[model samples]
Target chain A: MTSVLEIRNLHVSVADKPILKGVNLLVKQGEVHALMGPNGTGKSTLAYTLMGHPLYVVTGGQVIFKGVDLLELAPDERSRLGLFLAFQYPVAIPGVSVANFLRTALNARRRAANPADKGIPIPEFRKLLKAKMDMLQVSHDFAGRYLNDGFSGGEKKRAEILQMATLDPEIAVLDETDSGLDIDALRIVAEGVNKLAGPNMGALVITHYQRILNYIKPNVVHIMLGGQIVESGEADLALHLEERGYDWVREKYQEKAEA
Target chain B: MSEQVAELEKLSEYKYGFSDNVHYAYQSQRGLNAGVVRTLSGMKGEPQWMLDFRLKALDIFNKKPMPTWGGKISLDLDEITYYTRPSEKTESSWDDVPADIKNTFDKLGIPEAERKFLAGVGAQYESEMVYHSVQKHLEELGVIFLSSDDGLRQYPELFREHFGKVVPPTDNKFAACNSAVWSGGSFVYVPKGVHVEMPLQAYFRLNAEGTGQFERTLIIVDEGAQVHYVEGCTAPTYSRDSFHSGVIEIIVKKGARCRYTTIQNWSTNVYNLVTQRAVVHEGATMEWVDANLGSQLTMKYPSCYLVGEGAHGEILSMAFAGPGQHQDTGGKVVHGAPNTTSKITSKSISRAGGRTSYRGLLKVYKGATGSKSSVVCDALLIDDKSRSDTYPVIEIDENEVTIGHEASVSKVGEEQLFYLMSRGIPKDQAEGLVVAGFIEPLVKELPMEYAVELNRLVQLQMEGSVG
Candidate 1:
């Protein structure tokens, strides 16, 4: 199967300080990849770099998405290229409602996908939004509220997933969505991700714990240390890291460095 | 004045710059004088006392010096024509108006907006109201909606009692000028215990060149009554500066409520200086929703006097200043009686080297015990070149009063823009969303039509200013 996204030797810096020092990864359709490491290991930096944040300067990198060079695109252009990032902390836009935001995103994506396609009509958009909200178990009233404004931790996560479901991006990067969510919220988010994951969608689930992997099993698990991936294994590797902690990974990396 | 007009002529992109080709039946000489005031009074056939009031106001206007505070203004009094009448008399039907004048109001969306959801409608062209109408159902409910001139001719006793009570002639220089040369505005009166369910609207258009429009509006909501009045102002762009100095006074009597909403969008070469105030009596409420979007220099502070126990006042003001604009606007509250309350929320946006300032005052008199007041001012500067300022004066002599003031100035956060763009929205649209969000509290308080129009204007202003 052709890979949906490929990141090769990606180096990024913020404020002139290098954070992601040559990271490599690949995501293919119909599969879930987990990138896990301790705090301050630059996992979030990788997510931001992939999403084209201006603050995260890409020093040396090549990001290829569906045969196009993603590094040369703007954030909104990358989003139209079917790339999605569920932010660790979603920003609150006080007056833009969830429905309006989703509709705008959907239209932008549609225009990029097909030049001649008109935007979805309001009634049709409402119907599709209703279906997505119902599938994600999001309250109907949530769509009328401002996007992420005054939303609780769980509500923010659910709203993100709801957006992902509406946009139907080809590849999605979930950046620490389980950080502040409780078990119930974690299950709901994982379920939403699972329902949308198939031959049509690919996901890179970035997290710090193996707790969420229990709900959404990953095809491959990668252990990142200091800015680069140090190890890759099957799903059981996540459980092993949970039991021995990041120290075990650090020791393994240290042996390799010394050699 | 000719030099400024020559300068403004260099920028020809003003959409509403075209003037109609029509004859003015009664155009006064191009200046403010006692004879001009007398001629206006004579033309309206006013009583001797009314003429005396105008003459006294003219004396006050001459004695008082120009205001020195707020934004810098270079208006030459000698260059402004105080009055001009586009038609001989007010018409009750739009078809009866002169075709040229009718076409002007037609382009401004007067009758269409009136037919939408207005309980009463009034259209003013230049110095005089050309058309006035009220729905039959509302007229049957003992509601009196008429032009100020008609109010004086029809209900002289009522007009004489409360015409200049709230904003007197000597209140300020602009107030005195407006009192001296005022010509066209609305006079609305809701009887005791009757509520006007729909909004009464008036549209004022300035189509004459080198002229001044002084509209005097007075609204009285009697005991246990309720009313809402909304007015919109627009002016055709003239190379020479046009002036708009209006006096809006409202009286919310015991247990009554009144809301006054204004949306002012003049041409860039206009100076809009005005005084608007209200008096809230016992158990009454008064709300002022003012939005200023255009003009070269505007200094307006709508105030309220809480004259009875348990009175309440609310002011929601929004200002957007584009290039070559300075909007100095805020609200004032005077708690003159016991247990009165007031709240003021001001939001302003400045971009493209424009400046906005919030100047407000809150006063609690010596015997106004147990009163509470709060003021919140938030300003957003879209770029480094733009500026925003806040000046709040709070005076409290009553020890038992509670007063709070909060002010914040912010630049558009880069992170916020990135977050929005990551969702597939373009950069210009992203910036527009952020601005609309910033002023959401104030815009949401406006009527539906005005809120939509404000959002559209905000979007248009954000097109080229986004990073």
Candidate 2:
């Protein structure tokens, strides 16, 4: 089966500082890949680089999604091509209401997909948005407020998942969506992801804790240290890392790298 | 009278020079002076009191040198055409207004707007008001809606008491000039406890070449009255620099709530210098929503004097300066009474070598306790050549007051641009979106049509900007 995404010998930098060195990653369709990395490692940098964040420059490497080279494309083009990324620390944009923003994004996506698409009619669009909000357990009032302005941590996380459900990107890069979420919020956000997941969708969930993985139950767990993944296994790897901590893995990776 | 040599020269630069051919018995010859002032007053058949006021203002206008404290005004008094009346006289009905002048307002979408939404409408064409009227109920409610000149004529006692009282004639050169040569503006008096459900609107257009619009608008919201008045202006772009030195004064009597909004998109060749001030009495609230789009150089700072305890004032301003334009605008708030409050938020976007400045002042009097003021000014520079500056002065004499101010100038961050573009917005559109979002507070204050036009003007400024 063709992989949903292919990253070959990825070398990236954050603010001129060398971070991800020769990192190779791949995720198959219908699968969830968990990335567990230590603090100060290149976890978020890798995720941002994949999304083509200008701050994270790709010095050397190629990111191929389906058949297209992702590095050559812009973020919105990638987004239109069914790529959505929920940031670890999402940006808060004041004055842009969630309803208007979602409408613009969804309409832009629909227009790109169907040449003659008129975009969603207002009544139908509101109805569809209402049904999705019901599934996510979010209030209808959230739509009218400024996009993520003055929202609490748990609310922001749920809002991110709400966007993910709305956009329905093909390959989503969840950059620590679990961060700052309480247990209830974690389960709710995870439930949103599970409900949206399907055969055509692939997800790369980057996290530091085993708590979120308990709900999503990833197909594969990759442990990252010193900017590159050195070990890969089933979901059990997360439980082991959670129990033993990242220090043991770090020490063993250093020993093996030296050898 | 000092000659308007600059005004005549600028009017001479107006290339279209399209005269719709309206015959008039009298008009000011090409520029301003005591002769022009006397001619204008006599043309209106004014009483001696008004004539004396105009003469006093004319003397002060000549004596008061141009403001040197702030922006470069450089207005050549010689070039300004003091008066350019498009119609023979002001009219009281839409049908009575002349066709040539009617066509101008028709193209600008005023009559249709009045029929659809406004409670009343005032249209000023060149130097005089062409039409002024209100819905029947408002007129029956004792709301006196008339032209400023007519107001002075009809209710001289009322006009004399409040006129230039809030923003005195001695305030500045432009105010004195507006006081002396003031022609047509709105005269609104909301009676006590009456809340105007619909917004009253005034449309000021400078269609004539090389002219100065010295419209003096006076609004007095009596005790506990609530009113929202919106004003908008536009001019055909010309090569010669015209002048707009208008004065707007609002007196929110004790316990009244008044909101004065202005969306100004004058032509590029107009040098806009306006003096707008409001005095809020006990428990009164005043708000100013200002948006500036077109001008060669604009120096306008809408201010509020909180003279009564528990009074409050707010100003939200948005400015977009493109090539060959300088938007030197901001706000001022004076907390004169105990427990008074004020808030000022200014947003500016400069592109294509355009310049924008936030020149503001916030003051708390010596004995005003528990006064609070906050000023936030943010500027977004689209490219390298554009410039944004902040000059804020905050004086707090009371130790119990809470005053905070923040100002920052930021070029569009590459990360923000990339994040937006990665979402599929093109580079130029992305920059425009950031700017639109940056000034969203002010944009949200505009009416729908004006908001759309503001966005389009910002987009135009963004054209060929992103490399």
Candidate 3:
């Protein structure tokens, strides 16, 4: 059976101001969807609401993943239910190594799945982490450094991807992961996403620029404006927006609202 | 219900709340006066000069008034049993120790630690030493490790020369109290050019209710010698508050180095007031590692006096304050000679309405040119109800001295918590990880087993803090 995430009439507010208004979308396993729009258009808001950020209040919405209500759960519970958000600005946790954090996260997931389950043995966990790091082309020394503490832009993005690979979430929402990256870093991150998306997982690639869409080809493309997704089309729609900027989409949505 | 029974019921959650049923060979009456001091001195069969010293100390203790700073104190001096002798003699072999007392140390893991790494071990129960031993090789190197009473009885002249030189009875009221009724603490002397690799450990336990334990520890590191001394303390919980006032004096000779580490985890019904200081000679170094985790109220400031040229001192202090606990601890460094240097680092955590304060002083004398000092204090508050404070004083009379001080107070931010929890960690465990990171710098300096134990204790303290 294929897993599905259904977002219907979702409304979100931040600090008493609405950011996401009546948004609707559907994502299924083995499919990649791209969400593109101008800045401040509720792209990241939708991602944060999907991951249950406490600051993003869900005033009205129903987010069901695998037939379970995601909005009714805590952030940790949402994560344990195979929902992940690659944060735009990852926070640094000093004195916590990447290997240690990953192992703790894995153990938490295991214990949640079965109450009587002892955590992964140290040797086995080490082997698993090494395998994942090797698969992602990450240096072994990266595991020893403190989690994102003094990391550069490219390093932080790479660390995020490394975490995504280690966690193996079923549905990942990439919220502007390409914002602070150079060209080389952008290609590497896009390749990491491409490699992770398969029949076992689905992805919602949220971005502002069309350059990343060129690398990780999305099966369906959606344009968001004014707290609502305004356009849905085939892959060529991103190319159309790249040729002409969001000015045309703004005008089009303006005419539609007036009518 | 009686007060004692009610206190025992409240101590069910404490790990070391189990008390022994052994009979004390001798116990002083519940009071402190001239007669009590005389009886304590007479019981030890001390020299006349020592008796005179105790009598003078009693006068000073009576004259000094109670302090009105740091944590609050509600102790009644007239209601405390000042002296208790659990066994008649200190046993050199573990098998010779009384069964119940040995069982207590066994549960505390003293013998296992001794067999694994410690060069010497001293177990003090109530007011007397019950078990004492040193590795045969260290004993062959002219190293003297024994109880304070045995040190006086066997090596009187050496003990008399350096007993109270570092910290005298006139220093404070608690120091004077310890001076009058001091008993059962470690006495160590490392000869010139001899370096003992393993640490010498002392474990102090208070068993009786409404009693006081005043242990006097004196260590002397001779020229070019090196040693590390560690002491850990814990007591059973009771409704009636107990009092613990100890005085530790150390001397580091020319080119010698000494490190003293203490892990204090008394029960919540105890007031722990201790005075520990060391004097460093020319080209010598001294370090103090102090970790305070328990007790209703604790006021301790370990100090180092750099009295000779080219001396150095370092202090690393850590404190954890849980519900109804107040930890007032820091370090002091005094530079009396030229070309001296010192450093102090302190870290504290407060949770569940507990409070912690860092009170420190750095002083450089008039002629102590080219001296340098640095102090840093960092505190973490786990919730809105917790509290932390810092008071640092620096006095530099010399124009050519260098000084630096930095302090920070931070709460566990919601963003940090959210970031950790979003990765599937529960709220309480997430808070625990952040706290472990905040105190990582100090915890890394502890030994392997102690580092593990400290982390475990911090985890245990964080369990019920989150809703």
Cα lDDT, all candidates: 0.82, 0.76, 0.82
- Tell me, by DockQ, which candidate is best: 1
Q: Which stretches of candidate 3 lie over 4 Å from their true place?
A: A255-259, B1-24, B88-134, B204-212, B233-241, B465-467
List each candidate's DockQ score.
Answer: 0.73, 0.41, 0.69
- By summed lDDT, the worst window of 10 consecutive residues in model 2 chain B runs over B115-124
Q: Give candidate 2 misplaced runs (Cα > 4 Å).
A: A1-3, A111-119, A247-252, A255-259, B1-27, B88-133, B204-212, B233-241, B397-400, B408-412, B444-467
Candidate 3 lDDT by residue in tens digits, B132-230: 234465688888887788889999999999998888888899899899988878789999989988777664222211122687889999999999988
Error of 3 at B406 (Å): 1.2
Extract clashing residue pairs from model 3. none
List the lowest-lDDT window of 10 residues for candidate 3 chain B: B113-122
TM-score of each: 0.90, 0.85, 0.89
TM-score of chain A of each: 0.95, 0.94, 0.97
Mind giving the per-residue lDDT tens digits that candidate 3 earns over A1-259? 8889999999899999988888999999888999999888899999988987889999997999999999999888888888788889998888788988888888889999998988999999888888877877788999988888999988898888888888888898998999989999999899999899999889999999999997999999999988888999999999999999999999989953332
Candidate 1 per-residue lDDT, tens place, A107-201, comes to 77777778798889999999999999999998899989999999999999999999999888889999999989999999999999999988888
Sort the candidates on DockQ, descending order.
Answer: 1, 3, 2
**Candidate 2 or 1, higher DockQ:** 1
